[model samples]
Target: MAKKAVCIMSGGMDSTLAAYMLRAQGYEIVAVHFNYDQRTQQKELESFRAITARLGTGQTYEIDLDFFAAIGASALTDRSIDVPTGGIEAGVPVTYVPFRNGIFLSIAAAIAEKEGASVIGIGVVEEDSSGYPDCREAYIEAMQRAVNLGTRDETQLTIAMPLVHLKKEQIVAEALAYDVPLELTWSCYSDEAAACGVCDSCRLRLKGFELAGIPDPIPYRVKNGVS
Candidate 1:
């Protein structure tokens, strides 16, 4: 039997690519997506559903953690804050959803433990997020420590961040190499039908695919309300 892995699939480029990498490594992929009161949560989950079904993953799990609203100050959960443009060069941006990864990882780790999975997969890219310390190697390592110590299982929980050190362009190249369906993933911070290219997440995604010389399969509404 193939070793089991629980992939935290957010239906973004990085996480989708991470799933491909793990599948390439011969792990029985079990995708787990969260609906944590995020504005784009529903659309993102839909993307995951499509991608996982296309890939024929063993099973896909969807969990709703509505409790995240109580811990919400970030732009993703709270509508008051605007998603940042440019990058988050100025410390952590409003888009940095306040320990969001930590929350996701903790929940994923729990589910992995229940499923008898020793490895938990998350796709946090360092190059894509320069300002978020949570995406850094040090932070991931610390989280791993917490998971290990906090878990009751004898088997250690290993956090797998395959794209952690790669740039967005490199990630795109990797995704293409693995033949991942990029169109099935969504990365826009906006809740609209099409991506708002001006937002930080959309801009970075546009730049990544452009730099990698690949056509972005996801449709985008033209900037300034022009289709």
Candidate 2:
């Protein structure tokens, strides 16, 4: 039987590409998208729906959590805090949502247990994460151990982070090689229909495409503004 893989799709470039990569590797994919009430939730969710439909090899599962907004200390979920400008070299930036990945991973693991998936795919990376403690390799490993121990005799959950050690450009290159639908993924943290190219996330995405020598197909208001 083909191994089952549950991909956590945030509708971002890395996660979307991870889905395609796993699908190409012959793992049966089941995408789980969590609506964490983030600022880009609507955009990401819509794009995820379309991209999964286009892939045609997996089922999309949506989980909603309004509670995330109430505990929102991060700029991604709360408009009150500003998204820190430039690279966050000092430490984990305010954009780091509290226990965000932990919550997501736990939920994903539970879903994997119920679905009997052998592997759980996450798109966390090193370069773009800056200093987010939860995005590091150590955190991933620890989480994996916890999940395995918690579900040992019942279900096997292998946390797979293919992009964990790769740079943004490397991820983009891999995505292009896999023919991922980049146009269907949303990276900007803004609410506009078209991506706001100035945010930290968008800027990093733009740079990644540039370094990867790939033309980003996503529509942007800056590149095609109303005249």
Per-model TM against the reference: 0.93, 0.92
**Count of clashes, each model:** 0, 0
Candidate 1 — what's its lDDT?
0.83
lDDT (Cα atoms) of all candidates against the true structure: 0.83, 0.83
Residues 1-227, model 1: lDDT tens digits: 56888899998889999888988888888899988888788789889999899777877899888877787788888877777655445577777777778988998888888888878889998767847778887899999999999988585988999998888889889998999999888998875588776677887787788889887888887442345
- In terms of lDDT, the best-performing candidate is 1
Worst 10 residues of 1 by lDDT: 218-227
